[model samples]
Target: MKIPNNLRLIVNMRFYLTLCSALFLVNCSSKTDHIEMVYGQTGTSLFQLKNKQLAYTVKKEGQMVLDTSLLGVTIDGKNLGSNSKISFLNQDKVTLKYALNGIKKMADYKGNIHSYEITEADGFKWKLEFQLSNDGVAYRYKVPGSGSRTVLGEATTFKLPESTRVWYFERDSDWKLKSHAGEWLSADISEMPTVSKMGPVQGLTLTCELPMGGYALLAEAALYNYSGMRLKAIGNNSFKANFTEGDQGFVVDGTITTPWRCILLADDLNALANNTMVASLNPAPNSELFADTSWIKPGKSVWHWWSGKYVDFREEQDMVDDALALDFEYNMVDDGWEAWEDKWKKIAELCSYAQDKGVGIFVWKHSKEINFPENDYTIMGHFLDSVKQAGAVGVKVDFMNGQDKYIIDFDEALLRKAAERKLMVNFHGCQQSSGEYRTYPNEVTREGIRGLEVNHMQEGPLTASHNAALPFTRYVTGHGDYTPLGFTEPGETSWAHQLGTLIAFYSPFNCIAENTQFLLNNEAIAPALNFIKSVPTVWDETYVLPQSKIGELAAIARKKDDDWYLGILSSGSSKEMTIDLNFLKDGEYSAEILADDIEAQPINLEGLNKEANLRQWNTAIPFKKLTEMVSVEGKVTIQLAANGGAAIRFIRSKVEVK
Candidate 1:
């Protein structure tokens, strides 16, 4: 069937017109209105440098809202909104600055009365940009000329701002309650937080405001190139940075330029104390199209093996087979995988086995030591080539501590090379991903938080609480591999809590965080695993739902095909709670709910495929009138115990799909 040339021309014209319209909207939007307050009591602000004028102002709004500025529109007669303020925690302070030394505007942001030309450059292009007001101060620097490499990733920050008195419960915590920083940064910078891409996406992050007016930053970076997104330290080849009182921000004045680079700057400790925002920044592809926004869509659930901390080369084959039977996609065989001379070949075999079982393999290797003695991509490329030859899907690269020009260059180079090899990556033990995922899709997940890995504990802190609070905070920005699943593991406090984590945490490749054999102990947890498999990583709507002291609860509803997966997670005590099914489609459903069950046969992992039928339910729901109800719907009333939760799979057959 041949079509007319005129009709074809019209279609082509429409397509180009649509593409041009989208590009213009993305590149020409106002910067001042990017960060606006929709609703809230916190005093926030928006600022930008354009049209030869520096406009800065304050604002306040509720959660999940952006701050807007009519001033730019009023002053120049242009209705433009800039992402000047993404989001932030509740704290009172003044003076903030962020300086980026390598930023070259790609296009001009033409405002009402002003316009600034854009410049595009590769490598470390030196530049400085900062902002200071009553709200806070932020300083940033970007280094150019460095290779387009991303070495560091998943930075877990620990900061102590200089303004804390005795413990006050009203405050998020006497020592904790600081998850909103990631949101604040997202709202302010229009960016997402990132994690390291190492060992199945589990890393650490902590930032604190000290008692006397100082702040400390702690983090980790990855060595792999998932989709070519990463961070690296440029100076000292070290992973730690400190800021003293009276300092503008993190000092990179004398930092060396290795394959990694990093810089810190702040106006005061108080402002530093109130700043924290982390999430995936760049847009990721949904189907490996070099540029698909769906790929960048934030994922909150993952399954992996590192969380168990199990290291045994002899048992690698058995472990790999077990991981496949459990319905996991990405597996991380850390540490010991690289201990032998032909270890790469062994890993290749394991990857081949995993692929046959419908699972992707991500073998682990240290960033600093990989290809060591030789210290270059040539050797690294050979190793990656072997992994690819063995049918491996991805690699978990670890441990880059700082962000230097060289580090950034190396990171970018590695991503490019990894992309060429058709291998995805997971970065670990490094800095935040500002938005590199937008450019790379194979780079699936990273770790940049103090995750649920039963590791060393610090003084006076509820690490578990911090872990629970990250979803609404840092996760909003990007995909986070919090590494939440565990059964008979060292870090989990309760079985149900571990189950709830599947709902609380977000990641493209959510790690299982448990030993393969350990899953056999709790047959009840099979429902949780099934829930993890049934639920989609992307989301439609998310709400804190409710906040409490004992533990917080969160509700998330995700859509895939014609079904909706609604998950409810609780951290504190078990109790009866109500939920409205109004978000669901209008009609009846056959729901298979996997929740806290006191009495259920132990789950046989090998027979997991057969258990799917055990949890299904037949129920009727009317979402049309659901909004008018004062209480939760009848079927929504679920009973949860301390550290217990539920995952409901709503399959509506009342309406047929085309």
Candidate 2:
């Protein structure tokens, strides 16, 4: 979609996009035991072969962002690239461009790519490839031999420089965990506490403040047809890849290609938030299967499962009505819908009813019901066909709790089959999808973050620290199905905080998990409800505020059309934030700021605050609202209470000719 001549918004985002479009010259040099590549105006990567071991260093612009890091992967119990004769194969200059309906709308890639072949002592050889782009650099390995083989492990280690601070936590600390969700813990790499040797590190993303300068985020990308790769603290101020499925290793048939280990380098928070490296590394959506992506709609949905209500036909019908009233795009019928007598017919009736009302329905399914130990696309296809017949626009497949090869294959089959049926999907209780949405746009979101559901299961409200952590750590990889709002039970966060997440978090299907009946009846919230209704689930662009810090603050502005929604979140104490309106076009905007009302005492809702009661706080929401005129150069001051939030909608005001 091209921008209108009148709405020239990109001009206002000069500072936010300075680093994104710098023209650079590609340069490369190769020696007997040294290979150096530089992506001019972006970054440089240098590889060294010392004592027959291969190690590499990365730089952002001219400064060193990564110290030398050892690289290798073990195949059939033999070390390759760790201590082997690796010779350069070839190098190439490449360019890529694509568009997305979620996150950043479009991405253009101009970078340098190269490959090297390493010969094992026994004469076995494999190719190691690396690619560099504006946002980051990535490396992967490709095995050559055909037929089945059992690969053991990887020696791929990230040797962090001394004195760099890290924010990471041990994932899967409990061995029996089907877990990928975890909050970040901060410390120096040496002081990094809780290094669980038994657990797998999944997006432990602590934006490491490199000693030399800039920030580097170590992450994995394009995780397909392979058991997932996670990191573990190796205790030498380094992190190494660990496949948690087992030490025996994933059995592979024919030549196997490993996923890319990406090091996302950035100078500031905005660049980090806007980095498209992960999605860029993944393959584009299969154009053959989805010849027309018009059916793929990204918008807000009305969900009541988090409300913990029995969604009978009447109740779901009420919810659909609520969706219509709220101008929501979807209405979801969660788990246990199949238990209904004559389930398919009843569901189909409900779907028909919803369709007539101009609303779509989403149904849930257990993975085991459709995916057997043996690959069964036919069963999955049948289920998908039934849902499409029943009027479901999407499917929420629940309990997809592993990252093994079986899980990988099952997901691939389901996505292809679901797309063929024109039904979208969300993998509930699933591990981190690692940007699979780029490959299958119908895979809108997955449950990997310790979000709203877990937020409800715990004692008291979900901590603001946990809420603040997402944008930097978890969200950088891909969207998580947080189901981020609940008014009837605001938990510990303010009503405004619940509202802010709709913009701060990036999920194509922003399924708000709240009882809409309450929001409708409460006249107190009507003033600020328009923002909720107008916020888009996907954004054209996003700019993270300089005030933002992981686990401390989350302030961001997202653009769609001519409007920009700025969401502010603060952890721990109250804060006063002054947002520079430099990102706005040169025009007056009716800025609606929704903030916490400290003076509005809880009218009999204190008990719900102490112990979350899913029903009461709906009517007792005490939120404050203000509207004023502002412009491109103006600044807006927002006062947030302890563990509170604020949201502002910048709607361009029409200027009349006098």
Candidate 3:
């Protein structure tokens, strides 16, 4: 039920007074003010807000187990609940309501907001706010001040039950290069703090399976102006916040509000797959700046970087022509575009050509140049203006490399400035998304994943298992610029599996990372290419199929308008599965199936020595067919090859007027 603002304030005041009285009555006891707020529609989750710490738990069959176990942040070399005298000042409760624009899955979000004000022994005031919803719970800390304060570190801890199993990756300094492609290890929570080859840090997202048959995902939201937080297991099933290295921890000025620490709760893996709580914790988009987002289109782009080609003006023009031929939206002019003497003029000409063909252009720029310290604001403005004059639609800024306060601020400033110039932005070599795209609609996509681009590096190739794991991990946080749908160097996975990624991965500015000529010549997968060309980058709704497994298979169904797209991927081995279409609407729908051909000869990757030539492989294995009958109760069975997959598009049939 919605309450009026005035009535909400009055009720909050009364609740505060009642809590104060209760604290006074129990002042002599060790247990401080024992305040509890029940969340979730079915009373499945409970939050206990104490004077100094917050604890969360999930209930199963009338019995609740500690899902979060314990959570609180230490500040300025002092832990909140340890050796510190803390007193509650006041508390307030309200409802947070908002709608999403130009994104995925759900249209709106509503949650309960609970906030508390407290003072520590040293007179430092802390405001802790918690947002509780049916799907998840999140909390953040705010320290209001006039000048900068030195933060020694944080005590954000996640303690789970003894029998919990964790799925996580070890972190390293070269995280940008290794992104989400790290091999996930399953182990007991007590065996954590698993040291990586580089050091002793854990990845951003940690998925834990509770003893009570539920799951919880530990991650952060709205990460800005602070060093990124990672988990470090301190033994005894406890993980604490370990900030990115800095000389004096994290320095914060003005009113410092830390990022939202989130624990997403789910009954099953499918619920975890469809969770949108991370996006709910972020701020809404600034509509005043980008009121009309009609021109900000999200579609496939042709990239030359992945093909190992030095794209001169002629090569760039060829890519533009290929984009037009393939019905793609943009042609990317990568790294070396700025080296020519008349680079700007040449780029302007190419952009004009692409514009004439109804295709957009995206230009790449070094992050250091754009984030340059000397007169950066003016320099960036002038550069963006020049790009706008050249008729380019977006910019790909690369290699910022750190998540410190300086880099974080620069990222936000860059997005704001890019929005001002009416240009979409794609960030490369950046940190994982914290829903910044929701606030800046023009911020199309960010490469926080170990995408196919890393194929050229010395690191191990991204496997089908890694591809299967992304949708539940990195992609769940926000849009991942995985640069999907690559044909070159198909690495263990079949060509059909590569096609499936075009539908599986979610990127606003999706990159078709293959040579244009090769993609056009592959007649066997022509229909799949057409589907990829027409599929919407953003979706209205999504469903995770029951067949989904962490490193084995990932099958997803997404809806855009009246049409639905289903993508299925398999890892390590071949398997046959029947997919039920009951999630469809009542209307009859025609389906197009694209699957791996059993008759096709497999390319021997061992012979090619990991440096496979694209021209030599018999890459055409996907077989496409359209079904004659239409029914909402239809079931399609598919037999996938090892490291292969399938993509299907369903269109609802319409009745003709008599």
Candidate 4:
């Protein structure tokens, strides 16, 4: 069905009759005038013109949304709209292996819109799945039955014409262009207005103009991560992903690997948390098909004491000792170790001590420093190995500004090696994930956005927008190591807000990033940590629950083997949140409340600024219960000061067997 450029027009208007329910047909002159469209029976259509010029219209059934002047074809609702003009150098030179969905179950979806025939070029064969959906178009391609090991999708053969041009749409006029190789054009529209006042959809547009007179415009929500760009590659492969664009696409394509598989998320996490996918697609986990996956484990119940700019191992040892006392399984020693290799030996000395206390230590290493003689990859690897040698379980690799293909390959290889050596990984300043954890389970966490730590360190107060914005924005593609659950100084909220991080921030190896000495002062809040630690990061389900951001409030819930941990948070405001306790097994349970004292309480942020006694924490609150939803409701009201919030933990009681 490839259209020849010489063909003036192919208007098989008859196909339109088959699809348009007769009501969609419009009376027009039979004389092929300025426009021509040939529709197909299998939910596909083709459009072409002789002079390489075009114009058209696309409309959904009931909505008044109209997109006019579109010159590309669409399958279902997906538009294969490229801004770059494509020329077929060899139409007859087909490669059956260069077809889409050739990798089979590894990259192809079981339910897809189109099945394309394989093209043969020399001895190679390729399959291409070019389909359209109500939302956008997608191109899936693969080389049939290639190597035993996983090869980059770009290694296939989809030769582009000598020169092709492409462009994308944009909402903002004045945009900055950055240097990204293989990237013809780049624009940023982070400040666009919301398309709708509510609901999942927020609109932002990105346009990429190719050198060859063509362009591609991707219009999506203003949110981050959930959006993407399409890339035309050599051979038969087309790269499409969220954030990652270029040859690096082979290393970290979000659509193919980490499209937030809801089932995998459910199996890895919990069931009640599964509601986040009501707005989008979630690839089901492959493990559940035919095996007991109990070995598939997860956890984020630890403490991360950052070493970046602050490398005090002696202090860190004290912190480790404190974490061990708190019964935490993991403790991360953040950035800044190469400079203190001397300190590492001392930290290494206490490694067995920490382990003897049942605490696993995680060291921090720089990704680029892996090559320094004093700090190269070998020594860094040895450093990690030494930690392992000393009985630590993991290392958090950070500060990788070089997110190149080689860097990605090296990082993945590093994780694989570390896993083989029985060590876990946490990435910082790294590229977006590609579900490599399913391939290498030890890659436990990542810091991909401005997380809570940013809020504590000399920034404007962490707005409710940061929490409300993440789900549709950052959390769409993969897990985030947002280092949740700390009610110490510098936070503009209460212990409850910190508690909610256990639910809001989806980090498997959770970090109670504050000192345990701080929590011991508030034993009531100590139980909140126990509840947080008890809840598994791997859940049966996860949910971005319905709530209001008007008054600094957010909530999330996780399900773990019949126990549901629902954590609710409110920032510097007194607002009521309604929880359907009915979701729990019809039973009564104790609710641990952590709120702020409404009256003025002396709080300090000195410790956050490298000063002693950062902030003295104090809170006043009324704790009550609800007997009936209609008659009386029990909620902890927190009129918190700036940087103050509240937390509530729903501890599910065991149900009696009948």
TM-score of each: 0.55, 0.90, 0.88, 0.60
Clashes of 3: 1
lDDT of 1 by residue, 57-81 (tens): 3222221111121121100121122
Ranking 1 against 2 by lDDT, winner: 2
As for model 3, its CA RMSD to the true structure in angstroms is 5.7
* Model 2 CA deviation exceeding 4 Å by range: 1-32, 41-51, 169-177, 193-206, 373-376, 603-621, 656-658
lDDT of 3 by residue, 225-311 (tens): 787777778877888877666346777778878899887878776778767788777777787888888878878898887665677
| Per-residue error (Å), model 1, residue 421 | 1.2
What 10-residue stretch in candidate 1 is worst by lDDT? Answer: 617-626
**Residue-level error in angstroms, candidate 3, position 387:** 1.9
In terms of lDDT, model 4 sits at 0.41
For 393-444, candidate 2 gives per-residue lDDT tens digits of 9999887677777787888888888998888888876676577888898988
lDDT of 4 by residue, 376-491 (tens): 34665676677677666787877664343455555655764576567778887654444444444466777655565654454323444355434333444456676665444434
TM-score of 1: 0.55
**Model 4: residues with Cα > 4 Å off, grouped in runs:** 1-110, 117-127, 130-138, 141-297, 300-313, 336-348, 371-387, 456-461, 522-535, 548-553, 569-573, 599-646, 655-658
* Stretches of model 1 off by over 4 angstroms after superposition: 1-55, 60-314, 370-376, 404-406, 455-464, 490-493, 520-522, 526-529, 539-551, 596-635, 654-658
List pairs with backbone clashes in candidate 3.
Answer: 74-155
Q: Each candidate: what lDDT?
A: 0.40, 0.75, 0.73, 0.41
User: How close to the true structure is residue 654 of candidate 4, measured as C-alpha lDDT?
Assistant: 62
Deviation in Å, model 3, residue 480 alpha carbon:
0.7
